[model samples]
Target: MDTTFPRLLLQHASQRSSAPAMREKEYGIWQTLAWGELRSLVERIACGLHLAGLGRGEHMVVIGANRPRLYATMLAAQALGAIPIPLYQDAVAAECVLPIVNADVRFAFAEDQEQVDKLLEIRPQCPQLSAIYFDDARGLRNYDETGLHALDALIERGADFAKANPAWFEAEVGKARPDDVAAMFYTSGTTGQAKGVVHTHRSLLDRAKAGADFDALTGDEEVLAYLPPAWIGQNIFSYAQWLACGYVVNCPESAATVTIDLKEIGPTYYFAPPRVFEGLLTNVMIRMEDASAPKRKLFHAFMEVARRVGPALRDGKPTGMLDRIKYALGDWLVYGPLRNNLGLSRVRVAYTAGEAIGPDLFTFYRAIGVNLKQLYGSTETAVFVCMQPDHQVRPDTVGVPCNGVEIRVAGNGEVLVRSAGLLKEYYKNPEATAEVKTADGWYHTGDAGFLDAQGHLKIIDRAKDVGQLADGSLFAPKYIENKLKFFPHIKEAVAVGDRREKVCVMLNIDFEAVGNWAEKRNLPYAGYTDLAQKPEVYQLIRECVEKVNADLAADEKLAGSQIHRFLILHKELDADDGELTRTNKVRRGFIADKYGVLVDALYAGRTEQFIETVVKFEDGRSGRVSATLKIDDARTFAPMKAAA
Candidate 1:
């Protein structure tokens, strides 16, 4: 298994040719492919790529959702010693221009008509782009543009080439080296323009096997390839590890049908970010609101019992006889069915990362007997620098360094890592590569964190976002924001306190979600402002704040950043109002100036303040609305004493 991807494919074909290599759900039926069939398909595609003038070290672009053929396209490019660069399927056409032009991409594989249209739209900007192949042919019967071909046409051409030159595919595959570039992943461009992180075969396979060994993953493990393949995390889980462990990676029918497909597949290995988990929890809670009164009562009653006993039982801790008996009954009556409904009944190991997960969300899954845990990594580190082990999961820390990874904290609190998984360099950006990777081989993680007494790595926030309070303790605004937003009542949050005495926040309540909550309780309101100012709604948000504070108290770095006072904004932060960017990301400085009085009120310890916001309608109309906002004090907890 310590080899290149093409070699791995050939090895598996020779060893387990009859074993299932992958699955694709189409037309509501699951289609399976054995290792031998996958190898044959890869060969034909590779031959096609070879005849298309895709030489060694050339770059090809793949875009769209996690379809089986798209995955095959990536493999085919690699099989011909060409690098595959996947662009986010949801990104607009203009956004696709930079990557295609930067990579000097000449060939592209598109999943459907939509992706093909984007490439065509960007072709003038990226004039070097000469060839395009589309997987789905529907709605394209009349698109007779030059250099355009259906994927079946390429395969037909490839079959002819292979027959004429029988030794061509094997010779090309054998020429690939372990250190050859395998794939390139682009950064999210949050901090700056995106850069391509180049990863080699040796690096990708090494980290893949390390993770598989850590989790004891085997060919028997089933994975649902649901997230975008453009993300390094999804690529590692579905592509890299799939080959490493020979797991059965299943592609859902489509994005709209993922939930039904997830239930049908019942995957044993799952991975998602914190937001996906939050959405699932919200849906479950929203549906539960429609149950009969007695059913609701019974569900909550057992959930309380599950919250008490489930985690301890899962972690193999000692429990009282009565608690164990109650947990068993709850499992049979509530937890088991809920898991089946959520499609987690077969989940053996589930992971979350890419952002700080809320403690409440982390606990909910583990409390329901889902082995939900956290890991820490980024695109630059190949997405596996740290990972939590079974029975030792915690929300605050992102476990210890993974196998073959060495981690240390820099003088300014930036975490550093030395691992085989580190990207070789940023393609065509040597200066940027030098900025992160130093001469001593350590990759500056750009994250502020420290190792806890238990040897776990605790990351707070991006080093630039992390600051000290007036009292010289840490303030991580994002961490606090994530915790509050997990409650499902709070939609948007902005924490204020970098060098201040205490922390405060302005919140936007989820109107529909809170309205549903109010209606269930027979509470009446005139509108959003009227509903937000209700004392009962404030109490609900207050309890959520207190819970976040409790979690903060257990972490060494974030203990000082607990929410002290918070106010509900009368209006949502609107991009049209210029309070947020066009991407809907909060414009912090603009809001701070727009509501200067509110900020002063929070720090001045004022009980109330008047705030106003301009509103814009979809019909090109503008108006003004105003309301007096009330700020409430929330209780904070002292830091938990370290275990002796």
Candidate 2:
């Protein structure tokens, strides 16, 4: 058995010398990298870092979107026994800069000039940062510095060094150990400031190999590397899995062109957050509405059949010959083209993580034979905990504990996990480490959930967020919010009242769907902010909310979470307003502070009100907008009848 991941990489490279190891979209073309070439590239990069006045135990930070070079650099850092810290690219300068400074990163690999500029702006403040390297040199044509180096130039220099002193670099690579720090990732601090989660080579390698083993990966598997590299989910999928499986890792030409790149690559293995899947589903549904009448009818007809049989197929049940024929027709006429259009034609295995996936959303893909499975983990675990195995998958639960992972539910229902993949500690934050990891050894997941009869983990909500109604009924805000969002009309929702009178909600309507409906009715609106406040759109959303209420009332465990009242805010809840985090996650405390008056009005039985709020344009300009707010009465349904 291999003890170190680097050894496995070398072993695989030697075994599969000519196999395609990586595929990246460059200059509108798909580029293939063989195993030998990839291994060589990593080795050379590692050598370059060794030569750049860096040695064992140093720390390096990588910032930006996903790219092949980013993964190479991470491995290169590990190979040199240095720690690489990947920061979320979507994070604002202030949100991410502190971690880089705190980690004392001396050499940094920046994705582009924008990231380079951010580092430069803070260089004076960070005395430890000695050099900044940029992979993409698009806009930094004139920027000159004693410490800045372009990626290509570094690679060339590394090549020349390797030719001159081959044995010297080998000695450095030999210095790496299983317990050496490999990387440090900062968690998206939705509740507090981001803390660096530290991982060692053993922790990461164990999770990577377990993931590869679970998925039964082969070198032929192709994956699209597009999510933010700072996220552990993407890091595990793109870098760890790529290195473990020796598969072809494909990068999108750029973030903007991911869709085009996906269509071109048509990867065999795919992973996305529930939000990405939701966007794809919404895009298909929207296009269907605009398609020809025959096309629309045919699409719906086949979907109806798929809706019936997809679950059966996903559950591995026996469908009769007639249903099988219908499924075949649906796949050929409806599902095939639909999957192709969504760039999922060749997908063999798919995973969704970072949040809970709605059952309907999970079923829809599985019904179409997508093989999508849900997994459970966090940055602390190197992103491996419980994963639903193929053919035994369930949407409501994240499946059995992964290999080498031990999971147990604490008395209060918080999920506790212990595994080789657990992070070493939070960098410079011993207090946080002590708070999360108990003296007994279990790492508290903070999520409230339990294992089902089948030994699968079913998450309810955050342990801190799970509250009770005045009537002593359970109210899971996240579950209710997810149900509301399932409707195409509502984009996002915030369920209020932790211990107040009744549950009320603030909704952000889907602009595209609402805008299209408004256009059909000849209702003119300026933009998203304008469209959100439209009275006509308000009535439409009211109906959707009522339907959600009816559905919630039917569920005994969640009836108390039904929205008692709701309001369409004068403006959409935006990240720029401090109402949402950079990753689009709602900052509940921040939002409540910013919109205290508005939330108060919803519960106070106000029919309507006018408010002025500041809005930030995408260009970083600030402006004010005023609009009329509309409120709707709480929806109430008749009490459920007792079973006879």
Candidate 3:
């Protein structure tokens, strides 16, 4: 079988010409595109690129939300042996400049005027960028056309070129090899500048196929392509796996409409980072709080039953007949309606990756029969190194190694992987590539984890972020932080105690959750900073911290890592503020460095710390927010007594 994406796409087109290949929600209507239509569109675009002098070995950048045309543009570029580098569409011009300049991008496809403007703004920094094409022409009618062209125009040009040179398009596609670099993805660069990871067709296809087979995914399964295509995880799930398994992909109308579109589509296979799931659960809990007393009572009653037997039943574990009957009744009364509301009723297989999910949150989904599981991988591994099989899912462990993937722990406890999906190299950055990929074909995952007795991989934290207490007790900030974030009010947290006596944390409260809580109590405040400093808010968060400490105390190994001192951050952590990556993963080092004073206050026993932080707004404006943040101490629990 052909491994290159172009050939695989052609094969699907011939085999399932009339079947739905992709769908896009446009103007309140779902528009379907058939496999045959996709093939013709890709061919025209590929031909157009060829006519426009886009040659083999050249690089093209795709910047936009998930759209059918944007995806096709990637395949078109690949058909001509050109590499497509998808950048996060919401990224500022400055953030986008580095990869564009480093990759020496020659052609770029933008979604609309906003993306086109960003590319134009950064064009001087990327001299190699010759042509900029846009999909939506709205707001672009009066723009400079020096090198700007509409994607539709490009397709028309390609059609004309194909008539003139009929064999040229297929000839270019025929030249693709399994070993050829299929795509280039830039890392999120949580710690430093982003590096482009290059993967061959063989690497991506092999991993995608393995995952598809493991999940028993079929061509009929549907998925929502809402994540940033720039992220390798999204590419692996929405592109590589979609093509490999011939599944249908749906694009939400907009970011704001994802929830509605999700319900309308009811995707069979879904993937989200922990934060997404957290947000969904938070919303559910918030709504439940406002529900009528009778409804709320019914919900709690059924939830109790689900919590007891839902996971057992989900894993096919033996359960009492009475409990099974109770669970079935509860599923009808609570779980079924709840799943339908969250648009997860059809989810046969779902996954969460990118960061550690809170164990309670992980179990809650399973208990509700969502089939939620965890997987662990990075961009360097083409996004599949380990995956939890159904009935083998655990909240703590990510899963066993994927098919044909070998995982081992280094002496220092860093997880290393050797897999068919391992990236070939970091494009134009051999030094960076060499640092992670060894001569023996092992790719250093830079994650600290160990295999459990059951052979499941348990990720503690990033190798660099895992620290030790002053007395040499293990201090995993993410572990504690995840525990804190489990509380709906605590949206983001940073635990700091490396080489210190005890753990301290700085957290940002969920504005929506806390604000609503405050309003219900007649506690009026101005904004996030104002509301955060409120006495009632602090008390509320203190309870959350104390609860986390109690949970930590129950575990002998992590009892000493409980939070000792904490403070509510003056502002919410934002990607625009450089505290989070585009995908919402914390920039730990950056946050620590940026808020060093706050960290010092937590450790120094200061009652309050005055701080003024410079922040960036969505409109590219900069401003300062100053506040006196109060430090609070939480009551830690003593270790639980052993069984007697």
For model 3 the local lDDT of residue 636 reads 93
Worst 10 residues of 1 by lDDT: 580-589
| Tens digits of per-residue lDDT for model 2, 209-264 | 89889989887798998888888888888877777777878878888899888888
Candidate 2: pairs in clash: 310-367
Over 538-592, each residue of candidate 3 has an lDDT whose tens digit, in order, gives: 9999999999999989887788898988999899999988999988889988999
TM-score of 3: 0.98
lDDT-sorted candidate list, best first: 3, 1, 2
**Residues 390-474, candidate 1, lDDT per residue (tens digit)?**
8788888999899999998999999999999899999999999999999989999999999999999998778877887999988
Lowest summed lDDT across 10 adjacent residues in model 2 is found at 1-10
What are the models' TM-scores?
0.87, 0.96, 0.98
Better of 2 and 3 by lDDT: 3
Highest TM-score model number:
3
lDDT of each: 0.88, 0.82, 0.92
Query: Against the true structure, whose lDDT is highest?
Result: 3
Q: After aligning candidate 1 to the native by TM-score, how far in Å is the CA of 256 from where it should be?
A: 2.1
Q: Kindly give the number of clashing pairs for every candidate.
A: 0, 1, 0
